[model samples]
Target chain A: MNIIEVNHLHKKYKAITAVEDVSLVVGQKEIFGFLGPNGAGKSTTIKMLATLVSPTAGTALIGGFDIVKQPNQVRQTIGLVFQETTLDERLTASENLFFHGMLYNVGRQTLSRRMGEVLEMVDLGDRKNDLVKTFSGGMKRRLEIARGLLHYPGVLFLDEPTVGLDPQTRNRIWTFIHQLRQRENITIFMTTHYMDEAEHCDRIAIIDHGRIVTLDTPENLKKMVGGDIITLSVTDRERVKSHIIEKFGLPVKESGQHLQVEVPGGETFIPTLAVDLGERLRSISMHRPTLDDVFLKLTGKAIREESAGAWSGMRVHMRGRR
Target chain B: MRALKAIYTIWLRDVIRFYREKTRIVGMLGQPLLYLLIVGTGLSASFRMSFAPQGFSYLEFMYPGIIGMTVLFTSVFSAISIVWDREFGFLKEVLVAPVPRWSVAIGKALGGSTIAMLQASILLLLAPVIGIKLGPLMILKMVGMLFLIAFSLTSLGITIASRMETMEGFQMIMNFLIMPLFFLSGAMFPMNSVPPWMATLMKLDPLTYGVDALRNIVFAGSPAREFLIQFSMGTDLAVVAAMSVVFITAGTLAFNKIE
Candidate 1:
């Protein structure tokens, strides 16, 4: 059954339409990725699902509870890890978790047990008594995840969970997240701009301009191109292209020094084409298209620098620990 | 049961953290001392309120007002930490907790009032050093006054904090609301001898009721005091209790609506 059903979600900020007519359904126990570029309504949509902000026009059901009409139930059912750090620095790691458990109305005995369980899960068990302010960024992020999980929430909303971590720490967090999904049978809904991160998700909804452009599996998304890609770096010119086109009886598309031809079995036929074109080909490579290529194809622009900036910032945050 | 646990857990953590910070402890202890030393001493020499019913020294007459001032300042400023917490996002963590939202506001008020009460008691301990003497009955009355003042002011502070969206706006309201309440309540000057309209205004002021009621209890044995010590004693407490109910209700209501 679908655990989260979002229908035509709309959010506006004064003059700008942050999210417009966005809709999606996340099924039970599935790791769903809400992918988008910067300012493409990723955070705004997540905030609506998390009930941090109300939608201008939309309805979302989490675990069969409405997000707007029954917010308290919605809050109880879903755990949220905001994009920015939201833990109390003055409290110890254990204290923070214990307090979170209490706010969820967990009994004292259960709270203590869960606090210990989550601390170990986050690999911060030894630092339980230490103040959270003294913890490294990665450790703090882990603690935040632990705090959110203390209640064994049915669904977890991770908003840019690895936005500011090094690859090692990000991978570590992903490992723990995957373990939790298997161990607890929890549903995960996460938002990120990284293409590789999207690849890890079971299904990704590629969003741009405040709406979902496409929703499909990564392999299927690339398969949408319908043929293997042949990349050629040619030194010659119009004569060689016409000769190849005339001999092969196919059309050639030229982009500067490179020519792209769409034909069946391009990977198997590349050798024959290369032998026929001889010295005209300075270099040639054959490979399948990736998500970046898909993004480029759809948007007529490359993936943004904002995604790289987010990755490097997270990297610096990780290196600071060492 | 779970809600109580949460409140106590947060309360205990704050208490431990408060003690660990020696600067905060000293600052808490120091403010009451300064009031007793500077204000208590400066006004002691040749100071005689002809309106005072008894021949008690000004120090004897002003001790309870100083206690009121200490409680007033400490109790109201206790939520000042909350503004800091809100800015730092700690307040959000507490609000999102499963415990009822009123617990957050009440726990903070209680924590702040505890310090305010302690500060008031410490100010009382300095009375002998400053040469103010009171009987056992009067000492009991002083304790009663401290409780009323702390409970009332702390609740007021929490109400103000809930309405404040930013720390700057909160601080500004503190200056505009608290400072005037302190001055208009007649903590520093003689209210009865002022012009009639001003005296009526002072009488209408709640803090004025607090100060007058506290002074009457502290110096009830003196015959020369113009403030109706007996009349204010009962009414002061009733006013404080009524105001506490009003402010706490308003604070809790607003806190529930806070995102």
Candidate 2:
């Protein structure tokens, strides 16, 4: 059964349209990725599903409850971790989880047990009694993830969950996310601008200009981007390009110092082309299409080109102030 | 029941945060002491030269006002914390919870009021130090009146803070609003024979009745100071209670409008 079903969701703010005709379904325990550049209606759609923002036209069902008609039920069923830090800095980690459980009406008896359970799930068991102010950025994010799960929500919504963390912490968080899916069987619906993160999702919906451009499994989506990319550096690059195009029946585009070729299989194509142009080839490298390539092929722009800041996760090393 | 728990949860967080900041407690308690003991003693000495009533010291007249000042400042700080919460993204977590929006606002008001009341009760301990004897019943009555005032002021603060995005903005606005609320409350002077315009302004200020109610409880034993009480306890309670309802309702409405 699907945990979340969104139908043609739309949102408009006066003269501007934030989300236009967004429709998707997330199956139970599926790791769904809502991939988009900043301000591409990623947050708008997530907020609508979370019942934080009202949809203008379409309706959604979260955990079999209508988002508009039964907002509280939807809220009860979903745990939302916002893009920014939301944990109370003054409170201890356990206290933060306890209050979150209280907000969800988690029973008194169950709350203490779940507090320990969720904290342990996030690997923050030892830091349970420590103040959030004393925590590192990664620890704070883990605690928020812990607080979000204290109520045993059916779906966990993480909005840019790893935007500000270092690569190591991001991997650690992804490990926890996978554990949640495997151990708790909780569906995670996340939005992220990072292409590598999107590669980890069971399925990804690439949204652009407040619309979903494509939705498919990461592998299938990469396949849709079409073929392995093989780049060759040769002294006579133009001559090699003609021989490659004539034999492969494909177009070769010049990419700076290399002649880039796209073929059905890079591993097979590289060996055959290498033998033919053995003495002429200076360098040869092949890579499967990345999500960034997928986005560029579909949207004609790199995802990172539109991202505003390169160091959003600088909170990891800095202890100066929040 | 869930809604009530949500309110309690929010209130608990604020209370925990309040006590955790040890400096805040010291500041809250120290300000009122400076007023009641240092400045108040200096002013009472001049009153002794003029009227010279043994039991009717200026300290007795100003005690309620000092408490009111403390309540006002504490409550406003709590409201500013709401703005801080919003700025720092903590408010988003509360707003997205399954609980109703009104519960969050009420919880904030309760938290702020409870902190203010905590400060007031501690200040109430100083009554004996200032030569004002208070029975347990009087203390209970005083606590109730103080809560009403704190609740209303915190609600008003929330209403204003809800629209504010930054701490400095809320602080700037509260500075413009709090001084008039304190001075016009008749906290420093007896309200019996004020100028007509000043009387009209004091009547408009909600803290005026709150301070008056505190004075009624404090001046019960001394006939000399009792005459300085402007309104009956019932009238003062009614005014502050009405304001409490209005401010809380407005605060809840403001919270509902938040994104």
Candidate 3:
């Protein structure tokens, strides 16, 4: 059963097309990830699904309710955790949950029970009375997750849930997300640019320039990149490039001082290549294909290049925090 | 029932926030008191009214206007919270909720009006110090008039704030409009003796009727009651009620279009 079905969704802002003819389906209890760089129409697609932004064309359905005609029903069936923090700073943890519950028309007794259950799940039970302003970054994220689940929506949409957190905190948030999937039996739809994080998703759609370049499971996507990638730093790059081309008929590209080659089994071919090259090979390394490689192969540009500024800005912000 | 509960919850959040921040009470009340004391006392000696009855002073004439000022400032400034919530991302949460959008606007208007009325009530307590005696009936009438004035002013505020995006821009626009509205409302002088053009402008200003209604209620049994009748109490109330409906409808439409 597909919980979310989007058919040729398109969003246009005046003269610019933010999302161009996008379509996908999210199955029940499936952890679907939208992997893309900044401004790849990822957030726009999510906003359309969440019923926050109306599409220029195309349509979607959530829990069998049309997004355009039945917005209230769609809103009731989906929970959204936005990219920016949305909790009232003046309200306490329990107060925030209570406020959300009331807005969703949850009954008093059920609200109280769910409040305790979510608070305990997020490990904020001890600080329920503390104002949200005093909470740490990790604690705030946890509370937001708990708040998103208070209404018990069947599908939860998280927009970069761990963007600015440290590695440890990011791991803990993913743990909570995985636990929620197993314990509550809810489908999770998330968007992220982190390659390692995308590795955790059951399936990922790599979007670039307002289009999905590829959509497949983590292993299958990596497999699309073919075998291991081998790089050799040799004194004579041109000589080695032609030698490999002549000996094995494998295409070799010269990158600065390094010679790069792709083969079926990188480990099995390294010995003969090294023996033939003799002392000309200064250094050599073999690595399994990662999502970054897949992105580079599909888009012809490294993902890191697209997010370089944001990554550095995040680092500066983190350093200032410490 | 669900709509009412949502409205109540939204209104309660504003009340809780207002009470928790103690400085806001002092800040909201400070300006009205200054206008009443310094301006009232200084102008009283220089300005004596011939239209007023024998013993009525200029301070007495300005009292109701000052109440109108308090209500206007408090009610309109409360809408700035909309811009604040937008900047901080909290407004998106409220906007995306399953409830109807008008309930959010109504909740904000009621909350703002309640706060404005509370400020007006505090000003009402100082009536004795200013030589105005209020009976129970008069006190009830004054409270009722203040609530109407607050509700209308708050609706007007929300209507403007809904289209605004930044706090500074909203405050700048409010400052530009509030002073003109205050002066044109004839809060400092009687509307009966103004120039023809000034009278036309004053009649057009909604706050004028609010001030006029307050003056009528505050001076009902006094010697100036007959002169205050120039602005009919029933007419002022009716105009205010109609304006409230118009402004609220406009506000709800504006809020519904927010993307």
Candidate 4:
């Protein structure tokens, strides 16, 4: 059964269209990922689903309740962990959870029991008394997750949950998320620009320029490329380009100074190409198709290009403050 | 019942944070005490030798006004936390909660009013030092009036702060509004003696009734009672109570439209 169904949801901010004609569904107890670059309407779509941002046109349903007409029911059935940290810095971890539970009107007896269970799940039981301001970035994120789950929501929306964490911390957060999905049997909808993180989702929707480019399982999405990618840095680009086309009747795409080839088995083809090219080949590498490759093939631009712009924008904002 | 619980929890969070910050308590109290003791004593000596009215000393006259000042500052500044919460992202969490949005506004108003009342109560303990008489019934009336004053002023602050996006902008607007409200409230001078235009402004100021109500209760049986009769205790209480209701309704509506 689908827990979330969005139909042509659109959001316009002043003259800019943040989200336009976006539609998708999240199945019950499934991990659905919204994959996109910065300003690709991923966050806007999530906000509309969470009922935090009212759509300019169309609508959505959360747990069978219309997001606009039945906002309170939708809110009760879903939890949101925003992209930025929202926990009160002055409050202790448990105090923060208590405040959330109280806002949701959780019974006192059940609230305490659920608080303990969530804290344990996030491995934050021992640090429950520490002020959130004193916590590391990962700890604060974990506390926010625990707070989101305190009321036992049917669906949880996590927006870029591990954006600024170290690799080790990101892995730990993913571990907690997996455990949450397994133990609670709750539907999870998350948005992330990180390709590796998107791999963990049961299914992913690739959004670009306010449109869904593709939606499928990770394995199937990779299959759209049809084979492994072989990148070669050759001393003579024109000669290698012609040599591969004439010898194997295969197409070669030039990227900067490198030539790329798509083949059924790149590992087996590399040896014959290396022998045929002789000393003209500078270097060769082969790898399986990744979500980044999928995004690049679909949009003709690397996802990292947008990510770089986002990082610089954040840096400029921080510098302006200083 | 659930709405009440949500309001109570929000209020409790403010109170706990207030106590946790020791510097804030000292700063809020120290400035008012300095104003009461230094300004009160300095002006009283001049009035005594020059134009001291019958049965009224400047220190006794300034006591209620000082209480009003204390409550006004505390109540207005408490609403700055809303802007702070917005800047830090905590306000988003509160806005998305399952409770009604007005409950958050009501909770903040109550929290600010309770703290302001506590601060004014501490100032009340110093009444004997200024040679003012305070009967048991007068004390009860003073407490009730201060609560009304605080609630109204805090609600007004929230109404303004709800639309403010930055802490600096909120403070700028607050300073521009608060100074005029306090000055025109007849907190520092007698409304009867002011010029016609000034008296009109004083009458229009909602805080004027708050300060007048406090004065009527604090100087109930003093010789100045006859002069204070024009600003009757009943009228003062009624006006301040009405103003609190208006401010709270407006504040709730403003808070409901917040992003």
DockQ of each: 0.26, 0.59, 0.43, 0.50
RMSD versus native structure for model 2: 3.8
- When sorted by lDDT, best at the front, the candidate numbers are 4, 3, 2, 1
Ranking by TM-score: 4, 3, 2, 1
lDDT scores in order: 0.76, 0.86, 0.87, 0.87
Model 4's TM-score against the true structure? 0.93
Better of 1 and 3 by DockQ: 3
Off by over 4 Å in 2: A230-261, A264-286, A308-322, B46-55, B192-194
Q: Score every model by TM-score.
A: 0.83, 0.90, 0.92, 0.93
State each model's C-alpha RMSD to the native.
5.3, 3.8, 3.4, 2.7
Q: What residue pairs clash in candidate 3, if any at all?
A: none
Candidate 2 lDDT at B210 equals 92
List where candidate 3 sits over 4 angstroms from the true fold. A231-248, A251-260, A267-284, A311-322
Give per-residue CA lDDT, model 2, range B1-259, as digits (tens): 9888988898999999988998989977888888888889999877662443565678877888999999998998897788778767788888888888898899899999999998888988888878789999999998888889999999999988888766557546756798889888988886666789889999999999999988888878776654677789899999999999999999999978977
Candidate 3 TM-score, C-alpha based: 0.92
Best by TM-score: 4
Query: What are the fnat scores of the candidates, in the order listed?
Result: 0.38, 0.82, 0.64, 0.61
lDDT of 1 by residue, A111-219 (tens): 8988888899989999999998998878988999888888888898888898768899999999998898888768989988888888888888888878888888888
| Pairs in clash, predicted candidate 2 | A164-A313
User: Which runs of model 1 end up more than 4 angstroms from their true locations?
Assistant: A225-288, A307-322, B1-20, B52-55, B98-100, B132-147, B222-231
Judged by DockQ cut-offs, the docking class of candidate 4 is medium
Worst 10 residues of 2 chain B by lDDT: B47-56
